[model samples]
Target chain A: MTKKTKWFANGYLTLVFVLLYVPIFYLIMYSFSTGKTMSHYQGFTWAHYVALFQDARMIQIALDTLLLALLSALIATAIGSLGALGIYATKKRQTRNALLSLNNILMVSPDVIIGASFLIFFTFLGIGLGFGSVLMSHIAFEIPIVVLMVLPRLQEMSTTMIDAAEDLGASSWQVLSRVILPAIIPGILAGYFMAFTYSLDDFAVTFFVTGNGFETLSIEIYARARQGIDLEVNALSGILFVFALLLVVGYYLLTQYTAKRQKAGVKRP
Target chain B: MKRKQVLFEMPYFFWLAFFVIAPILLIAYQSFFNIRGQFTLGNYATYFTSATYLRMTLNSVWYAFLITLFTLLISYPTAYFLHYTKHKQLWLLLIILPTWINLLLKAYAFIGIFSQDGSVNQFLTFIGIGPQQILFTDASFLFVATYIQIPFMILPIFNAIEDLQPSYINASRDLGANNWQTFTRIIFPMTMSGVKAGVQAVFIPSLSLFMLTRLIGGNRVITLGTAIEEHFLVTMNWGMGSTIGVVLIIAMFIIMSLTGEHKKKGRKHND
Candidate 1:
């Protein structure tokens, strides 16, 4: 490429990054503003943060959101990992392919359709929408993701290890718990984290299933935002944004550490 | 052991049958009926017959198309540059990091930036330009949607570009291929999978943007999602809502089939 083309590419990329991040930085800055509007940046104040903590309902909703995400991720991980293992072990290609395709239905379907269907289904069952339905909906969407994650790891593993374990008279349970589990733990963890974030960021699906007296943080934010913009949300958003960034950074650091250890001729646990 | 393995899968199968298969079937089934449990083709007919619904469908398609186009336009070069950079991982992380934040929060941030007295106007004013109304316009709606979707579009394309073997590029150069030729013949085709995925990721969500349209578009941007929300929430017409839901589902399938990978049948048979 010519020098002008190179300069143009660099400039274009820089501009894209600036556009991507400016609003985020703006939001973070305004979170500390004493004024209520976004136009003027007034003297810095901790009032929004103070109010965010003081709002018991918002705090409760945040906790509820985290708890729901954790529970759904945990359940989805267990079932999905087992499902992947079973599918991997299946002798018939058709059965395995069929199962995989069935799993993709949830993955491929639009979120709104999933949300709407869940809404109609829950109402039809006469189960009043609340935390329970929300959790179920989350798990339903998350399982396919977990399965896809773990399945790849399983496929990458060497079947010879299992055969060798069996030759040594190891039980199936022993082989699974000892060899296979340790090998695919990273994939499982990755799947869990991915599922957790999906649950955290989910609004469209949660919007339909979430009902009277139950609200996730996203739902609450949506409600407040639709009514009018609230500065308190900016404070909470600052915290959430930092929390997500830290999670990604921590995950990256963990992987780097493990990779370094492997490079140093240390065995992966 | 195989029997036990099959047994282990039973719960998942049941879950899929109930949650995944049953719910969608219920929506399809409900689409043909009115609120009073009377069987009718009225809901689908109403959707097909009404100008409002037709317009909404077109709007959804248009928005999805535009957002996808813009996202790819911005993301492709960014991904290509990042692929060649030494700090690829760090830059990629920065790109992916914001996506972890909630979509509502991002939309809220855009609201702050796009508001009448917001930073965009404030900055323009400082530059001697009049403070133009940015929020609630078609421009702001597309801008916010494109902003939210950019990261998603970038990651897939970045992965595809990163996975492209350097040897192919080198070979193209060795074969006297020009820069443009290498890009068009080698890099672009190799990155088609990523393009497909990125398009799917960005386009699908753009079609059904509910909160962004309401908060950012100020309800002026009436897409299919807005229509569905109205039918369910405001109109109390579950049948019509389900009808739209069914249509949306069909549209998704059509998009998938259009972009889906084809199997090489003769090669597989030979193998």
Candidate 2:
């Protein structure tokens, strides 16, 4: 890390971040523009935000998105932890590899392919198009992400910790509750949060499976974007953008603090 | 040994058998015989024989290939540059910031970027470049998809390159290998797995890209994804869509196996 190389890397990093965020920044900027003629600048006002708040459709869609994310993420997280347990318990290499492969399918498969297949699967099961079906599809995809995040934690988990708890007279459920859950809770939390975020934002499979009547925020965004975007939606997106940024900042600070503490502490083991 | 094998395998295989393999097996069965009304290979035959479906599958494949290439080209440099950064944690966050934003938001953001008087055209005007009002076409669709999926390509590559010991490069250079040769021979080969995984990550979604195609490509892009959507939704033709789904699954399985083989060879070479 010489001075010249340091400067070069830092400069490039700056450019990359700029590219990453510039569009969202522009969207935020346009939210306040008073003129309908889209331009770089205009008289600034909170009129758009005010209008956005009053829009019932946007609010309904946001609620729908939240509801879907909460339900799907909970189910996915439970199944994922269980799947991880089953995976970890399996000692044969071939069996473990096959399970891992199957779990990772959603991460690899093309969304359209999965969506189309799921549609067929559900239709075959005699399920009608509606909320229940949408929930099933969301769970199908969300479970894989949960399995991905939690499985690593399970693998890295100290076997002695679980053994110690069981030796202390904890039953299987008690062991899971008292030690295993606590041990990998951070990873599970991360998985659940990521799942919620994904389910909130997903459009592809949701697009395929969602019934005609129900709409999520992603669907709203799609519909708004398609029918020509309005500044009101721009303002709403800005508000969400700001909220997401704040949450990310908080998480970063929290992680950095823990990392620093971990660096400072004596070895707990 | 037999009992040990059974105990070791039962849970993992059971889950797969019931949850994953069963569904796929069902799909495979249904693909051959229409779910509700008929029983035959007519669905598969129709899709295979249709000139339109063949062209669309190729279009989807090539779209994915080009996107993979573009993502690798841009991401490798960015990741390479970031590898040398001191403030990596924050910088890494920035590299993956697009991923944190909702995918749909990012997709919509591109529309804002490439709209007629969008940011791109506005910048072009300021710089005295070509025509005004540029958006919504095959090119923009590809561009938007690339923009959305670039982070997927960068993360694994960055993480892998970060793990590479600097001593290897220094060793190569000390042995009088030039920078270009050292990078190609030592650096690239060592990092091939990450690159392959990243390429797969970027390419698969891009291959099945339907939302962006419909939105940005104005439904004219006619990808395999769009075709699936059209079949299952508009025309209510599940049989054709299922047939295409089987083809897609087979193609991906082939890619996975080939990559697995490449991975094995790479490991052996290193050994």
Candidate 3:
């Protein structure tokens, strides 16, 4: 491209990046302000962070959110990986496609629809709306994503390896544990990570199902935000910003490491 | 072996039945019931006949359209230009990083920026316009919604652009076509799938940004999502909410069908 256009493109990209990052940084920046509102930065102080740490309710909710994400992601990964495996092993294309579409219903449905429907589903089943309801909903919504993530890896695997394992007298369980699982471990991890993030980031579904007694961080922020500006939320955002950054970095590194290892394995063989 | 495999897959099947299929059927069934628990088609009747509900649906679609339009306009060029940049993957990751932050926190951030004494107001005041009420306005809502959706739009389009073969552009140039002509005839047409995917990603969610309407729109802008939330949570009208949920699902399907990849036709095999 010409220098003028190149400059223009660079400028445009810089502008878009600024727009994207400004809000996030603005929130994080105000977390240090001694002022009560985000509008004014009266001076820098760690008071909001200190308050965030000391607020017992907020701390408990954060821990609960973490626990919920971990448990849901774990269960979803196991079930979803097996679902992907089953889909792969299906001889009929129609059954496989039907299953795939069924799996994606939750992925495409708007969160409100999912939340409303799940609320109805829970109430109909006589399931009380609380931790149990929230956990189940998270697992439900998370499974589809986990399936999507792992299915591609399953497809990429060579079927001959499974046949070879069977010919060597490996049981189905042995084949799964020793042959298939190791090959798709990266996809499984990726699915688990995605599920964890989805559960953590989810608001609407959790909001609809969560009883008055239980609130995730998103619901709490929503409640607090409606009341007006609170720097404690900003403090939480600052910490979350760091946490999300670490997660992305870690995920990126993990994927890169796996890719390198795969290349090395291929080269050796 | 077959039995073992079926047993292994049992949980997934159970999940499919209980979570996916059952909730959908339950929602559809619930839509037939009125608020007082009587089984009737009144909720659908109310949604279809009521002027207020009709107007709200139209407004919600319009706002979502606007958000999608603006997001596309901004993101297309960003993605197009981003393709030529060094370290584009890293740049794309940076684009995606904001999304990882809790959406509520981002919305909360805008509350501060657009508030009376927020940065935008301060800029306005500096420009001699003085501080106007930027928050809770249609403009602020549109801006934030578009902002939130930009990364999603960009990612798909960038992938599409990256997927474009350089040979096509070079061939177009060799055939005496200029840059604009080449882009319109070759690059843009090839990237249509990505644009469709981007729209699919942005438009559906845009229709149901209930939290945005409440926090940024100041209840001035009521989307389908806001209505559903109000019905389910505030008014305790699960029936009406489910009716709206069904409508959203239908809308989702319509969009999916419209944007979904159509199979290529009429290609003859050379024997």
The candidate scoring highest on lDDT is 3
Q: Given candidate 2, what's the lDDT at residue B73?
A: 86
- Model 1 chain B, poorest ten-residue lDDT window? B258-267
DockQ of each: 0.74, 0.42, 0.89
Clashing pairs in 1: none
**Residue B18 in model 3: lDDT:** 97
User: What shift in Å separates residue A212 of candidate 2 from its native position after superposition?
Assistant: 1.9
User: In model 1, which regions exceed 4 Å deviation?
Assistant: A1-5, A257-269, B262-271
lDDT of 2 by residue, B1-271 (tens): 3465355445444545544666676657767766466888888887878998899999889988888888888789788887776787787776665576677677776777787777688888889995564466888887778878788988989888988989999999999998789989999888877888887787767767877887788887877778778877888877777777788888788777765676778667997
- Per residue, candidate 3 scores C-alpha lDDT tens digits across A185-269 of 9999999999999999999999999998899999999999999999999999999999999999998899999899889978997
Q: Output DockQ, candidate 1.
A: 0.74
DockQ of 2: 0.42
Residue range A64-146, candidate 1, lDDT tens digits: 99999999999998888888887888779888888888898888777778888898899889988899999999998999899
Reference contact recovery of candidate 2 = 0.50
Worst 10 residues of 2 chain B by lDDT: B4-13
lDDT of each: 0.87, 0.77, 0.93
